[model samples]
Target: MDPVLIMADDDSDHKIERRRGPSTSTLSFSGIIAVAGLLASGVATYNAVQNDIASLKRGELYQERTNERLSEELKSVRIEQRETMKEFNEKLDRIIDQWARGRKQ
Candidate 1:
């Protein structure tokens, strides 16, 4: 082989080796951070769901209690109204009887 040609071949073969540079470390670090973030997000979502369920249960219990209280109040009011109506009717009957007696006389 010609000397010049061989030297040219050696130079071409000795070309600078390719390096990963900072990309390798950056990718590894980014991957680890991304995985950690995903885990954290999952945990947060789970907690939020649990909290929502608990809150709903509490609200439901409160609503049931409120409904029961309102129902009791409505029942008492109805009973009072019935008693008042009975008394009014009795008074009206007495007045009507007296009026009828006066008319007859």
Candidate 2:
């Protein structure tokens, strides 16, 4: 530790004295509290970011599943439409054939 010299006045002559000041190693109460609050805030921010990332992942998964289901449903509807068209065309052809034969007779 460094000491500061102080001068004093006496009856006959002047005298010299030593004094001490605040130490660098020790922190005040308010300083300690401020540091602790900073640490707590940092921890809270980190956790919040982690939670947001997880939520985004879940949302992505849900969207992919919904898209897959929609594709499958569209494929099934196309197949059903194809079958209906085939049946209608066969019945029309049969009717045309019968009309032509009746006209010939």
Candidate whose TM-score is highest: 1
lDDT of 2: 0.85
Please, what are the lDDT tens digits per residue for candidate 2 over residues 1-105? 223323222233754466866555455766788999999999999999999999999999999999999999999999999999999999999999999999999
lDDT of each: 0.95, 0.85
Candidate 1, pairs of clashing residues: none
**In model 2, how large is the Cα lDDT of residue 87?**
96
List the candidate 1 regions with Cα displacement exceeding 4 Å. 1-26
1-105: candidate 1 lDDT, tens digit per residue? 899878978887567668656787898999999999999999999999999999999999999999999999999999999999999999999999999999999
User: Which of the numbered candidates is closest to the native, going by highest lDDT?
Assistant: 1
